[model samples]
Target: MNYIIKIIFLFSICTLVVAEEAIFHKNLKIKKDDTTVNVKGGFKIIREQFYKNFKKENNLDYNFLEVTKKNPRHGDTALELTVGTGCIGSKADCKRSNFESKKRVEVSGRKIGKKDDNVWMSMSLLIPEDFKWGGRLTIQQWHNDIEVYEPMFETDIKNFVGLTMKNGSRKGYFVLDKPNKNCSAGSGDGSTGANFCIKSYQEFKLLNWDELLSLKGKWIDIIHNIKFNSDPNKGYFKIWINGDLKVDHKGQTIWKTHGDVEKYFGKNRWDFKFGIYTTSKMAFKLYFDEIWIKRSCKGLKLKRLGYKCKNLLDQEGGVKPYSIKDISGNPELAGTL
Candidate 1:
């Protein structure tokens, strides 16, 4: 009986390992097609499917999303997300009725990003020629969940980083933030008070938001490599625009809860949201294609584009991770931004 139990236990362990590896392998190529983008936790809430057949067929309920073959980055089809007039702001998933009538049609990857996740993502974005710039538009953001525990003590705050474009300006900037040390229970709401009492907020402006007007009606590739960590020394964020290294910042990329060690810390509590999220009255359209997310750079195949991945040896003192100084000295990444 003991021998038979041991055999069954080993089989179960082997099966679990195989299942884990299969998920990573399958995620390596998250279907590039339009109807099946395979973004886990794609939509937030389903109020009511106005178009029931579309939801049944594609597993997507939004009317603003479509699959087009006009100008795909690599494949035959790309996703086009639009927000037009007469669109009900409350129909979409957002905090407080379209962010105070800001309007949004987003794809939520609410299950992807997590604590201590070394995530790499690459995608191509197109700003249509007729896209009207008005107010603030958040193209992509790495947002954390707002947890209300016990006596209504909100924790883990807002997004740590986002890619934003403003109205009447050709320049774009990255919004980065960390938690406020002085925050306590029953603090201010996230809508006001320095963006939910964010302690460290920095906007790193590198180049044109429109890429010198050359990106209009054209596709520009963007790549992000993020090491999500609350530790100031271990976390790093790197971005490449049009295959050129544009932003490299080292520090905390996510916020942790205030108390407890086992329950609060080391939890996967972050996600990624993309697509047009704007406050402008004018309707806007955007295209996304060639979207890829991976766990490591070993298979990104971006070496031909002059991309280099740093190798860290986590020994006693073997090799340290690349710093801002090292990135600045590299000729391939120096002059572009």
Candidate 2:
């Protein structure tokens, strides 16, 4: 068994905004005469319009999603969880909430407006060595619809990014809801159904066992930056692990042509959620922090609020893990965040 990496405590979010896109609006937007878009977190807690951090200890709050301050990755507390289990095969082999295991935490927020631009968000995560490889772990995700004019059941599957873990490895994939010219989402291809769509995973992934073990007990920075497109064939997806750019994909990111898209939702509005969502028999705990979405570093308010930023996050030198060899017998040569 791999040495149980006991990484925990403190978490954060980061979002960058550039002030150049005056055509759009949001927490992070471009100011008049400004060319930079300000970055900020995508989450907005009740009573607090711009929540910089989860500051209160033991004070878990939210609506439509679960919140726990027991196992904080930063600040005085964090979101703690004991995942529920799921089933497979015949119906006889399953039972409970339609035989599904919805064990996870979500930072639920109002649907942001229709957007067809560059969107990015990052979160700090601490997973213990025991977090397992067999469970269905969807640590983070972004869900949106292309039928902005009205809610269309089919469009729900049109675009999404789910950062999932399977067979002991980390993977982030994009599932596009592509319907033909006559393909009314309501009809779902008029045969195969809405679940049928195009899917692609990150090229450079955190799949190396030795690589994951090296950062087991250390806080790893997992980030997702996406460029939403309308052509369903011209967008891009990117990811960074521990400050290292692991996945950089360019191509179609959504499902819609030049005319199918409805008003408002034409550009598309997406819902951002993060936390532990798994189907594991055994209980699991995950710590998350530094949740942010922005256009640049200046858009991030993590440090401005005086929230502690751990310098010892690096697995090796606490600053440069790749510069030397770790005890796990792996040579880390590319971690500097």
Candidate 3:
């Protein structure tokens, strides 16, 4: 009898382990890159449900009220909204209220090249303040251009990640200066500009003209290797262009303020902001294939927590109307890390 009871207990333990292990690897899609883990089959984003949750989730608030633009220079379907663009307003006020009310901000169903040509769509997620920054933000576009920005309110500049454009152009520039006053400007030529401060976060500076020219035709990847050291206000910032070292800064200081992080994250801590911003006189197009965010890891074992692929079909078997969860799945798991 005793032996039988022991055997039963052992079986139950084994079954529990198997169940937990299955849950971990069930929706995983692994890649050649040992560090990459494609996520799958979790909480699917139902557009209507998600919009409702966006309002109910008090921890986070999104402002995506649509505005109409009159005599739009573009086609009848001039403006389109994608993932991140919808949340332009919160309970407080419209972040884009400064823009002309007539300048419409709506979601379009058109495709930019092989990708969807959605305009003015922005996505934001509320993470815990103590949540460590992991993974990398990968943005790939085919014919449309995107503007990526990180506004860290509480954390300093060192905690912030910079943006890298691939086969595209970006306008407008802002620099973080001492005290409260910061420098604001636009790109000189029709090229993209990197807005970073060297004094605060070491090596967090814009790419030179020559470096920018080199990455014109090909894809550009910018990885922010953050070093969390003694000073909470200081850290390191490094960038890799096309898998090559481009910018590396040590002992960087990033300003930490309630307003900065709140402006982006709506709470405070670490947040990422990215969108498509064209030149005032002209509109640009760039196609994005993938966008992901990476967190800091010991050694070189970095983990890809979140990623999105373009043109991902939905479960309904249709392709016209798109969504984030349709194509964005967890990186598959070949084995264990």
Q: Who wins the TM-score comparison?
A: 1
Candidate numbers sorted by lDDT from highest down: 1, 2, 3
Candidate 3 — which residues are off by over 4 angstroms? 1-206, 228-234, 251-266, 278-281, 296-337
- Tens digit of lDDT per residue, candidate 2, span 1-337? 2333322211111111111211112322222222121223334322232222321332323222223333444444333333334321122112222234333334433555344667666566666767655534666556554432211101000002122221100111122254222111222212221322222222233434556556555666665556765443556666556555555555545444334344523355555655444445544556555566665434554353333224212222111111122222221211110
Model 3 per-residue lDDT at 213: 40
What would the C-alpha RMSD of candidate 2 be, to one decimal place? 16.3
The worst-scoring run of ten residues by lDDT in candidate 1 lies at 149-158
Q: Which RMSD values do the candidates have, in order?
A: 15.9, 16.3, 21.7
Ranking by TM-score: 1, 2, 3
In candidate 1, the residue pairs with backbone N, CA or C atoms under 3 Å apart (3 or more residues apart, or in different chains) clash, namely 170-209, 171-209
lDDT of 3 at 28: 20
User: Residue 211 in model 2: shift from native, Å?
Assistant: 2.0
How does candidate 2 fare on TM-score?
Answer: 0.49
Can you give the TM-score per candidate against the true fold?
0.58, 0.49, 0.32
Residue-wise C-alpha lDDT for candidate 1, range 44-112, written one tens digit per residue: 321234333434554532345555657777656666766665333443322332134445555555466
Model 3 lDDT tens row, 80-159: 12223223222222222223111111221122211111111112111222323322222222111111222211111111
Best by lDDT: 1
